[model samples]
Target: MEKPTRLALLKEIAEFLNEETETYDMMQGALKFLIDGSDFTTGWIFFIDNEGNHGLVSDTNLPGALVKNNCQYMQEGTCWCVQAYSNEKLTKASNIINCSRINLATKAHYQETDGITHHATVPLRSGREQFGLLNVATPYTKSYSEEDLELLESVAFQIGSAIKRIWLTDQEKEAARINERNRLARDLHDSVNQMLFSVKLTAHAAKAMSKEEMSKNAFNTIETTSQQAVNEMRALIWQLKPIGLEHGLINALSSYSEMMKLNLNVQVDGLINVPSLIEENVYRILQEAINNVKKHAHTDEIYLKLSQQQNYLNIEFEDNGSGFNINHNTEHVSHGLNNMRQRVKMINGKINIQSSYEQGTKINLIIPIKVD
Candidate 1:
């Protein structure tokens, strides 16, 4: 490509990156723009998280061999470029010594390579933080000239900076969300919750003072309604600002169980520190489990065991109560159980529930954890 043309393409890519907020879309669009505007016929980008897990985020014009099996080869296993980037050796744009995925494709007899044997790899980085790799390849291209490498490096820098910006923006948004939730929780607790408590107290006093049956019934009804409202407001407040979560998950659950006046037997095997997302979901699930037991299980005592393994966190809840058939109870299947399943699925975790009539219930949850 000509110098002016390359500069113009870079300008367009910068504009696209600036306007794009979604990471995957930004990367896929940038890859397409790079390949379509330059001499490169194929390109792909990889995203390496803090845990060193790599994912093929975007690609353009992949050959049949690489695209086979839904891009299995590219998605799995380490390649030369990835290893070099991970080891801090691939800081700038340079030709890969060999393409391992291509070699494997050739060995598997997927002959539609389109002469693609090597790729120019550039480490996507912004200052000190390393993101991943950006690779561009053209048919029959053995090496990239210094000027070409410089251009690739410049593009990679733009991509890396854009990614970092997006991540920071997301974090800021999340922090704002949490702050707003806490503020609302505090306001509700101070204003509406206190008012409901006062209403309950006044109604109770009025009921005791009234001598007429009709007057007593009216005051009694008012007291019951205000008490129920107070309980519901407290539940909402807990959801907004999970009690004792800042200390730990166990503390939060124990606090909730105490509020519910249920006997909670807790057993822990390992240290419990998890991401906020996981911790919140687990707390909510257990909270719901405790509520279910108190309402439907007809049991005052619950057993909970939490254990942390190398790459998985396991939690179990057992209650010996009036269990119902899982397959036959449509209400149970559709409500709380469904919500628990959705929560587990949201975090890429697994949940198992075993219950039978008069046999009690056991719930097991397994969540993957990224260890630093």
Candidate 2:
């Protein structure tokens, strides 16, 4: 590529990155664009999380051997570039003489490599934070010139900066959501919740003083309805702000279960210390689980256990209720399950639910803890 062409491509990539808001879409699009516009015929990007686990997030024009079995080889094991990256040795664009994945394909007699044997590897980073690696290859290319390496480094920098920008934006959005929830919770408590309380008090007073039986009955009904409304409004407020969570997750959950009129048996085997985000998510998920039991379980008691083993936190909920088929495919059940799954996924966790008719229901959650 010419100097002017390289500069133009970089400008285009910057503009493209600015226009993209989603991380995966931006990465996939950028990889395709880079390969299409440059001399490289294949490219891929890996994303390394805080715990040093890497995953292939984007790729383009992968050869048949690598693409076989849905790119099992690339996704499964570490390669030379990845090892160099983890060791902090691959800081800039440089030649990788022996790509491990490619070599594996060659040794296995997979001849669909498209003549690719080596690739240029660059660490994708912004300042002090390292994201992952970017590797690009062309057929029969053994080494990259200084200019070529420089161009790759520039593109990698662009990608790293874009990744950081998107991450910060997501953080800002989550902060905004939490702020909005707090505001709404406050408004409901001060207005609707207080009004319902007042209505309940007035009805109870009227019922106590009523002379006519009909009037007494009317007052009693009003009192009951207002009380139910107050309880529901309180539950909504708890979901929004989780008032007692600052004290501890167990305390908050116990308080919530009491409010919901469910008997909860708790057993904990390990110390409960985690980030606030994880606590909040767990609290929310358990709230839903308890609600499900109350509405469908035909039982009023729940068995809860929590334990920490190694770097994982495990939680289990069991109830001897009239459980339903897991594959029932009901709209409400599907939505609730999907919501729980999404919350767990956000924290890189896993959830499993088991239930059958005439039997009981059990839910298990496993969340990985990151240690610094």
Candidate 3:
């Protein structure tokens, strides 16, 4: 590549990063720009997450078969470049170490001969912290020069800075979400919750003192509704903090059921404490399940059974209510069921729902849990 062209490519990549607010989008744009500017046929970016796990972040300009094979190899196997980069031995752009994914790709395709699979890698870094590796591969005839290496290094720096900026933006958004939740929690506790409490107390006294039948019935209704609202507000406040979830999953599910005005029966056998992350997912799944029941079940009673058998945790939520046909595509079947399914899958769990006209509904979830 010429001097002017290299500078133009770098500027274009920077502009592309400027337009992107998401990390993955920036990565895809950067990879496309790098491959388009150079003689490289295809390229991919490998990023190390905050947990120090190495994985492919973005890829471009590769055939479907080649991309699949390379992605699988990279996911399952190790790379010398990434290992050396982690150890601080491979910071700058270098052609000294080759790529194992490229070697695998060559073996899969006979056309990729001995020298055609070679690639150059540079560390994507900002200051002293390296985020990932940028890889560009071309055939033997179009081998990279020193200038190409310098240009890739400069591109890596720009991408690294963009990645950091995207990360910071995510952190800010999460902080904002937490702050808003706290504000809502405080407002509910200070105003609505207190008023509900007062109403409940006044209604209770009025119910006891009233002699007329109509006045006593009115007071009784007021007391019951006010109590229900207060309970719901309390649950909402706890959801913002998720305080009791750290204690146990069963307790959290029971409390959530009470808030929904459901007569919940909890049965547990051989249960053990799981990680907080898994517990959080479990709580979310249960909450969604209860909401689905309240919205569609038309019943105020639920049976919940949780058991730890073998290496998995099994939970069953059953309700005897008006059920819909499962054969036809029903609108109610998609939203809550899909949300529950996604929550289960996020924690490597499985969920099954069985429902039919007037037969009620039963949902069973089997989640693999690690016991300490």
Candidate 4:
């Protein structure tokens, strides 16, 4: 036999790896490239799945009688490929009948009427990772030469590199998907939920107390309820107001309080600590709790307290006007109550609202210290 040109072989293998974009196409092309140019009577590409079972990734035109009679069955245990990869050794079986190195599966499948087969296989391995085996066999009772073994090893190397590149690309795509989910999760908790809470609190308070009632007690109930609605509006507005909340929650809250004062003359006292894990949702929850005081308490003077406790942080916004029952009053704005519930739950903290129709509203928050 004439010696095969090394340059031509390398060029042919490079084209095989670079030419195919899809995975199965690459497998089929690589398998056929090895079998067609030579006179291998029967051969197939062995594919190993995650569960370690082996099957034919693809098989080109081999002798019909050999494979169709299921002469060499298409599926078998993955042990051959596994051992090749695991040992990092080249496997050469001269005659399947007399070959003792290979396990029974190979003999049971490939041992034909000719008594045995000859094949050489090298693990398609790149770095320390092995994808499967590249193999070629003939139904003749003869052994493969050392030269044949060396050539197939080169082919296996090319196949392994291609498998690694394909695997890497898939991992990158999966990582991108996870990052997108994290950003969307933050947005929903901060912006969308806060606005809806304000709407609910205001509507409920308005329904419970009458616009028609003129008596002082009746009018006070309406006033307190209406004010609670306005405060929730402040909370929602603060939450929806800025993309600049990353400037720090303190600045955003202070700016919002200034804007509300011109219209309602309600002073906002805010106490805030730097947030853990991006602070965006924490800011929104605090804003919702404070506005509850402004809207429902109807106080001209609201006190803000910000302090940190070991392993926990506290934010207090209190008003000295009309306080409603934290548990019982459906009349004042509790619209954002549920929204705050969600935000705090993410960080494993809790919110407290204390007040009644005339006692004034005080909002307190206790959140865990989760430093990003």
In model 4, which regions exceed 4 Å deviation? 1-6, 19-22, 47-55, 62-72, 77-116, 138-141, 145-147, 193-372
Q: RMSD in angstroms, candidate 4?
A: 19.8
- Evaluation by TM-score, superior candidate among 1 and 3: 1
| lDDT digits (tens) for residues 1-372 of candidate 1 | 453488898999999999998777888998888888888899998876544557787999998888888888888888777777777777789988688888897677557888888889898887897878898999888887887788899899999999878766754665576678889999999999999999999999999999999999999999999999999999899978887998999999989988888989999997877888678778878888988888888888999999998878899999999887887776854598877875664555668899998888999998877511
- The Cα error of candidate 3 at residue 357, in Å, is 27
Compared with the true structure, model 2 gives a TM-score of: 0.73
- Candidate ordering by TM-score (highest first): 2, 1, 3, 4
C-alpha RMSD between model 2 and the true structure: 5.3
Give one digit per residue, the lDDT tens place, for model 3 in 1-372. Answer: 452478788888888998888777889988888887776767778876433457787887654435564457666667788678777888799884456766676677646343455678898987876778888877563457898789888999999898777766654564576568768888888999999999999999999999999999999999999999998888789777454665688777777777678888888887566666567667777887788778887988888998887778889989898876655636776776776875664554667788887778888888878521
Residue-level lDDT of model 2, residues 26-110, one tens digit each, is 9888887788878899999987654455788899999888887778778888877777777787778999988788888766656
Query: Model 3: what TM-score?
Result: 0.63
Model 1 worst lDDT run, 10 consecutive residues? 341-350
The 0-to-1 C-alpha lDDT of every candidate, in the order given, reads: 0.84, 0.84, 0.76, 0.58
Error of 3 at 336 (Å): 13
Q: Could you say which candidate leads in TM-score?
A: 2
State the weakest 10-residue window (summed lDDT) of model 4. Answer: 93-102
Model 4 C-alpha lDDT per residue in residues 38-123, reported as the tens digit of each score: 54544566755323545567666644333543434445343444444445453432223333323343544454323334455566
Relative to the true structure, candidate 1 reaches a TM of 0.68
What is the Å distance of residue 250 in model 3 from its true position?
15
